[model samples]
Target: MKSINGKVIWITGASSGIGEALAYELDKKNCKLILSSRKEELLQQVKNNCSHPKNVRILPLDVTNFEAMPQKGREAISFFGHVDVLINNAGISQRSLIMETDFEVYQKLMDVDYLGTVAVTKAILPHFVERKSGHIATVSSLMGMFSSPYRSGYCGAKHALHGFFDSLRMEHEKDGIAVTMVLPGFIATDVAKNALKGDGSAQNKDDDATKNGMPVSELAQKLIKAIEKKKMESYIGRKEILAIYIKRFFPKLLHKIILKSQVR
Candidate 1:
């Protein structure tokens, strides 16, 4: 089994869902964790639950605050002396059609889900490059690889991450920086309820499919293993992962079916 003992990992969006669960799982392996999110209270709560409570520290931050990330990352590095891994998992979901989405809404999604991740990654890249070792793990939706209705902004943001990070992996391979792109199907997170609608309001409710999706704990476990093993890419979830295969081998048929499917 892959292990993360003695490694220092920085995880964003650690206040809830997959991020919070990952803190618990990784803590058990005695990995020093720097947990970040907008909610300081929630981050503290998560830190308290870690198996190695003393090894976990909270660094509340808003991912979109690009100007502040460099200083924040320096603070994070000071917490553990060095960071071996960075998980860019903080993101918001969009729940509106392309035509219905406002320009600001789309921009916000990109700001948080794409540019936000990019900003943080860049802030920490020098550290990894100097040391010649680091890992980057991010959460991307399956829709990122295959577009679906009612999630145009979200898909755009997620798809952008694939393009940016995939290129970064190639360029940084010589620096010993590993990038793992995690594609999750339907995860049992509050993302649906928290998703933004066309008018910039919360969807304020969960979808049936999301309610019955994979548990947060399970996804966290799988992600930790992926990072430890330095896997290039991996997908999590139930039946949704199969869509990647269908789109690859049966593109025309998949498109026809998706056009009529009930995604929203």
Candidate 2:
């Protein structure tokens, strides 16, 4: 297994939820952290909360600003002169029906959730290639593997990540680059409240399923384990994770079950 202790790791979306939880967990592991997000103030707050606050640095970033990512990547690497792992955790969710959602909503989802990730990865690809070592771990939802109502745009964006990252792994395997796709079923976080609505507005509300999902701390532990093991794909969650297998062998039944769950 790969050891992350003492490695310089950069995490996007470090201001809240899963990202924030990871900062604390990784801090405990003695990992050097560079936290990035649009909210610089919140990133600082997360830094202060860490057990090893001195080991953490804050790098504010707007992942949607595609043109700026290359610079950001350079700045991230400069923090410790080299970065060992990058966690692509910056993303927004959706809570709208396809029929009612504006086209711009889909665009925003693609920009932030799909293309944004690609941009960041591309920004650091050259460095990884030159060094012949790196790890790219992304936080993709279970929606990436299967569909769900009211999450059409989200599912689409996440599904695209799998296609792109899988290709990245295949093309860079000889270069000693590692890719791990983290497919989370659900975790207690603000993802639902921050999800976009049909009109491109924040939902500003939490859902039952999300409120009762696995704790963020638990997910962080599992995420670190997956990274250490260099898993190509890691499914983490409660019973919701079964959907992946069910969709594979019992497609129709999975569809019926999802419809009956009324998750939205």
Q: What is the number of backbone collisions in each predicted candidate, taken in the order shown?
A: 0, 0
Identify the leading candidate in terms of lDDT.
2
Give TM per candidate: 0.97, 0.99
lDDT of 1 at 247: 95
Against the true structure, candidate 1 reaches a TM-score of 0.97
What would the per-residue lDDT of candidate 1 be over residues 1-264, giving only the tens digit for each residue? 256887899999999998998888888888899999999999989987776789988898999999999999899899979999999999999788888889999999999999999998998999999999999999988988989888999999999999999999999999999999999988899999999999999999999889989999999998888888888889998977888999999998788878877777
> What is candidate 1's CA lDDT for residue 3?
66
**Model 2: ten consecutive residues of lowest lDDT:** 1-10
Worst 10 residues of 1 by lDDT: 1-10
Quantify how close model 1 is to the true structure by its C-alpha RMSD in Å.
1.2
How big is the positional error of residue 225 in model 1, measured in Å on the Cα after superposition? 1.3
